[model samples]
Target: MLTSYTIAVIGGTGPQGKGLGYRFARHGHTVVLGSRSAEKAVPVAEEVAARLTGVDGAGAVSGAANAEAVAQADVVLLAVPWDGHDELVGSLDLAGKTVISCVNPLAFDKRGAHGAVVDAGEGSAAEHAQQLAPEATVVGAFHNVSAVHLWGEYDYLDEDVLVVGDVVEAKQVAQDLAVAVTSRRGIDAGKLRLARVLEPLTAVLISVNRKYKVNSGLRISGLEGIER
Candidate 1:
């Protein structure tokens, strides 16, 4: 299974994955929605295509396995779970491409994010992915974002993106992806090392969700608006 990577969403079968795939496709990126099964991926890609502004509502996209998608994409989005995270990174061919890691590393039974993968140096899932995918420029982003809200519009969720990556080009690609989806902007938060802090925020947000009983997000208020 291989989806071309002009821009591809790996694990696009999930809710968050589909939302981003849809948003990026809407922004005119020739998107591939990656899944374990190509047949399963087709419908999701078609659904995203149906929403694009200028694209024929009948637009079609490619789908394939994780590696094939990454191989072809200029940029790749990783929305896989924590368990699959390192495994995928270890197997990917990231010679010159920008990699986006969108994992939160939270363990849950029913309530949600009850625990985290404590083995990581900083216990950050995104940082772990950055370490595993050293060859690729790993950027940390979209961990706590609500895909349901991102897919449509939910007043509770604000869309500012925090881009963290060691490589400037990769970070910019991440920023572009973020800006394309949300009405808000992307802020480069230095290097990928910072994901140690950002990843845990997923757990923190979970605690907030438990306390407030709602999906919540962050918004840094004073920066002037910037274009993608």
Candidate 2:
């Protein structure tokens, strides 16, 4: 019983956002790719829609201004950069919405990427998001999913999506979306606080990608028969 949702992806012009929007549309969810302005987002949405024109089970894809997109959807995904996170989230009215935060706070240097220190909430981008939008049920997920693999031609991605949140129902929505993307397990990793660990963990995966010259992802074992 897959439920269709109207998903608004903030920063949807970015690679990660566009990739996730494609998957959501592929699964029959109406996807609105949000940018600072409709002008920027519309072309990208048209491009994505063009790519999915004949794909089976694909749903409608559109574009709008960030706030307008959020106003039109029940579910909103924050995929913006860490630098503009607070201001963008604070400006939006996310009351009574299921908000998914996949914005990893990371900084790159000559030494490669590392987790940037988050000053608000519990020191993770998700927690900070929750802090800014107290009325929104925020869930942390899709942090480690590769944009490259997501945009690839594969029918299903091969990896586990770890979901963390304080609210059970909101977390379940994220987990369901994860399964929608992977068609596999979406593990309930733990509470929202665990986002502290998960956000930083992406840096490690990025390093692995650089070292191996491949897009790497996570897969958990030992839960074959257990319900997620």
Candidate 3:
């Protein structure tokens, strides 16, 4: 059995953040949906809580300002837009928490969306997060999971999330959280430096999603240890 965690989602009003927050809350984790405006977040969090009326793990949702969310969470998931990544991290003091970086740096034009080439000065988003919050155990994950499926389509997620981080215990916490969200498995893709490769993969999945009109996800073939 996994220990229940107070999970804070930074951009919890947005589609991706909201979906992830909903799933976590429905599975017994305490979810704090955070937004720049507390007014906006509170309503959305209430709506999500209302939807879980008859669900098994209901009534565990709440909302707050971004700073308060981080202050109260055992694990923080950074789901903000790439443009806002630096500003958000700099303002928070994530001294000894487990931080998961789920931002995929990407851009779009007339043709389609593509991964933005970020210098990061350190490595990738997770690595950059490590620099900003030097005492936090930052992990890169949730890059390939579809927000649509998370919120609207499936009750049980059958996908693999590539979890990359230097800290072993933090990575295990991420993997456990992944499993708690309806059987989704978190695969240890490598160390935190590997995020440079994992982040760009989201762009390719988006391009395919545009073509097929499907909220497609990844499945690892040979991961025997990860339970379904």
Candidate 4:
């Protein structure tokens, strides 16, 4: 397993990105919160670092513009909204990096949330990312995990992260990192194609949360002592 990593959260000013950044930092991995501008991300990074004060095993936290953050990171997590997903991702030079996409393309309406139709026709954001940056190894994960619980006062979340990728080595890297949030290895949900299911599943979780007024997450069964 990799001992340490410099993780860059692309949409770090947002709740999901900030929450993930907090978790990674808490686990002793360097985290850089990235936004369109460094000015927007710096204060948020400061706020996250402030919250980790006196916390054991916390790593260094910083902020930068998206491109700068990606340039410095070993692993990059895309948590930006779907609207600008293409533009932002296409703009970055992500060659030879492990890119974890947690962005869910979904449209919210009066009825509820549902998967948005992707223009790339790749079925999910992860696949779209793969298309845009073919040189980078793209993995799909953290789609269904709760942003609230991640940044909340909880020590660790009780959930299973489903990681999908065409590359086995890259997938394992993401699985190992899952312990930072879920306190367990991420389940190898299958190839990058499966992201179609995992991405849209977030909408179902959101709907469930609204109905039950709880932060719902996934828990896989029958995998006891089974390593993926």
Q: Write the per-residue lDDT of candidate 2 for residues 72-174, one digit (tens) a residue.
A: 9989999999997899999999999999999999989999999887765358989888999999999999999999998899888988999999999998888
Candidate 1 matches the true fold with a TM-score of 0.83
Question: Which 10-residue window in model 2 sums to the lowest lDDT?
Answer: 116-125
Candidate with maximal lDDT: 4
Q: Which has the higher TM-score value, candidate number 2 or candidate number 3?
A: 2
Give the 10-residue window scoring lowest on summed lDDT in candidate 1: 52-61
Collision pairs in model 1: 1-65, 5-72, 5-73
Cα lDDT tens digits, model 3, 1-228, are: 777899989999998899889888888999999988789899999988998889976538999999899888999999988887898888987989999998988888897887777784346888889999999999998888898888885777777888999988999888888875548657888899888888888988988898998888888887676553
lDDT (CA) per prediction: 0.71, 0.92, 0.86, 0.93
lDDT of candidate model 1 versus the reference: 0.71
Query: What would the TM-scores of all predictions be?
Result: 0.83, 0.97, 0.94, 0.97
Clashes of each: 3, 0, 0, 0
Residue 99 lDDT in candidate 2: 98
Candidate 1 lDDT over residue span 1-228, tens digit each: 122236778888899888777766655566788887778887777767656646543224667777677766888788887776777767777766777888776667676665474564555666666677666677888876877676884322455788887778777777766755665447887877777777768777778878998777777666765553
**Model 4 alpha-carbon drift over 4 Å, by segment:** 119-122
Model 3 poorest ten-residue lDDT run: 114-123
Write the candidate numbers in order of decreasing lDDT. 4, 2, 3, 1
